[model samples]
Target: MDNFYLLLYLSVAMFIGSFVAGLVPLAFNMSEGRTRLLSTFGAGLLVGTALSVIVPEGVEALYIVHTEKYLPGAVQNKDRNQIISNSLIQPVASNLAAKINYPTYFGNSVVGKGVVEQMQQSPVMDKKETDEYRHSEASVNFNAINQSIGYSLVFGFLFMFLIDQISKYLSSKDGDRTHLKLTATVGLVVHAAADGVAFGSASATNRAGVQFIVFLAIMLHKAPAAFGLVSFLLVEGIERFRIRRHLIIFSVAAPVAAMVTYYLIVVVENDKSSTDSATGTLMLFSAGTFLYVATVHILPELLGSNVKDYQLVNSATEGSSRGYSESRASLKLIELISVIVGAISPIF
Candidate 1:
């Protein structure tokens, strides 16, 4: 299937999933406990996706880029003089060249008849020259690329952290905090856009297994995120119509971003190395964001004041000790199982 068609399918699925997830809370009037549970499950899935899928894929992509960019050149130069000598001595050198799988430099075959003729006229490279070439190859640093990716991951995490902090600060200020809600909404919209970028970059890989894993991971969290956003707005006492409008806008952001990013990757970037770099960086960045969302944001909310209050009251009121213990243990067990299920679900 065409990559664009697959992207379109994912975008449509994301839109529908988010819209439905958001509507479900309003339609069913789901309890706070259930909402928290769902959020926890989603958080677990995000964590699992980050560790099990995105990070590994990002590292693999970068290594592939490294090999493509550097290894071919190294291999081509390894026995250049030897190949050149053989071509000069042998009449049927081109046939020998066809048998030997030598690397091509700048798309020029090293042992072609034309190349051999050129080599016959030129002086053979000296030991000093060969040593110089090897030295130059050794001096070429790929560690910087690895460091850049690492920094990009950290930047992604910090970027989201800053947005969250800024929104909180704005909301805490005097007067009406509706603007702050908008701020938070914008932040979430940007995050959704990042998710789109990830999807685009992953699609660029053209690997069915990778595409499926990424698509599933994004879908797993997309709806729950939308549901949580709507629930937040509801708690903020925003009007129904306004919330609906916001939800519509939110649902569109990811798909639109995905389409735009995918176009840029396929058309503008148009090179394997660049595509790999972009895709790997995006994946790592997305992983960092997912880690923050899962651990710092969602988990805390899942185990928030309600749980603490229940524990405190149960401890103070000892008359129903057995029942309280049983209920608490059951809830904890359920939460643990839900998280475990979420974490491993991506393997299928």
Candidate 2:
């Protein structure tokens, strides 16, 4: 089907996943153990998606873009000619050439005849053109492009890290944890938007596999992330209606961002090289962002390092001491398993 339609479908799926995740805790109060398990599973999925799927694909896509953009047309033409001459079946080679649409080999060897005629007509003009082409070609360096992508990956990671840090700082300052909760929600909203961009960019590639994996990765985290956000607000004594509004906004953010980015890249730019480069950078950036969230933000909370500071733990402790500790240990084991399963799920 159409790539745009696929993107829209994925965006709607993301919204539903996030909305359900947030709604569950509000509808029925979830135990802390269950919440931790879900968060851990989501974290595992993000990590798995990043390392196993996103980073590798980003590198491969960028490499292909670099090769296509920088490689001289003459070299491609020469390669095509060599393949045609060496082929045992002339018709098969001819058919392959036609399918590939090799400009040099198409329509009575355009490259050869055209070059010969041009050279015969004006040697000085041809010489000047060749010199100019070589000079311009020298500027399209792969090293620079690779470096830019690397920097973008780092920037992506750092951007999320900054957001997390700011949220933490705001929470620490606010006695009621209201500011902290809101900050965290806002940060996540921004992340969801970034996830949308990643989705849109991947869809633009027109590769079903890439689109599927990316969609799965985003969906896996969206619900759990929303659940965490709404759960935090609920714990902070925020009204249910207000929480729902926040969830609605959060759910819509990513799809809207994805649609906008997709439209810009696919419709506005309309350049294949630009699309590939932008897509690759966005993927790498997303990988970095996912890495930070999974490892730094989610894992520590699941492991109970911040349990004492959590409202759920404090409230649960006020009721029963023995049950909380036992549940925590059991839940930790469950979290480990969930994380393992999440990380490996994409492989199959």
The candidate that achieves the highest lDDT relative to the unseen native structure: 2
Query: Residue 69 of model 2: what lDDT?
Result: 51
Q: Write the per-residue lDDT of candidate 2 for residues 1-348, one digit (tens) a residue.
A: 388888888888888888998899888876765666667787888888888888878887787876665443223224533433433344454455446543545456867555444433431223465466446663555667778778867987897777656655655665766555566667778778878877877777788787888788787777767776787788778999999998998899989988998898778887888878777888788788788767665664455434444432221111112233333433356668999998987677
lDDT of 1 at 340: 78
How would you encode candidate 1's per-residue C-alpha lDDT over 1-348 as one tens digit per residue?
387788888789888887887787577765656655665577778788778878888888887887665532233444644545544555464455556544443245544546655544544445676577456653464666678678877987886677666655655564566665676567667767777777777777676676677677666666766776777777779998888888888788888887887787676897878888887888788788777766665555444435433221111111111322233333367777878778877655
lDDT of each: 0.67, 0.69
Misplaced by over 4 Å in model 2 are: 72-140, 174-178, 306-331
- Model 2 RMSD in Å is 8.8
Whole-model lDDT for model 1 versus the true structure? 0.67
Models 1 onward score TM values of 0.75, 0.73
User: Candidate 1: lDDT of 329?
Assistant: 30
Q: Name the lDDT of candidate 2.
A: 0.69
Return the lDDT, model 1, position 25.
Answer: 59
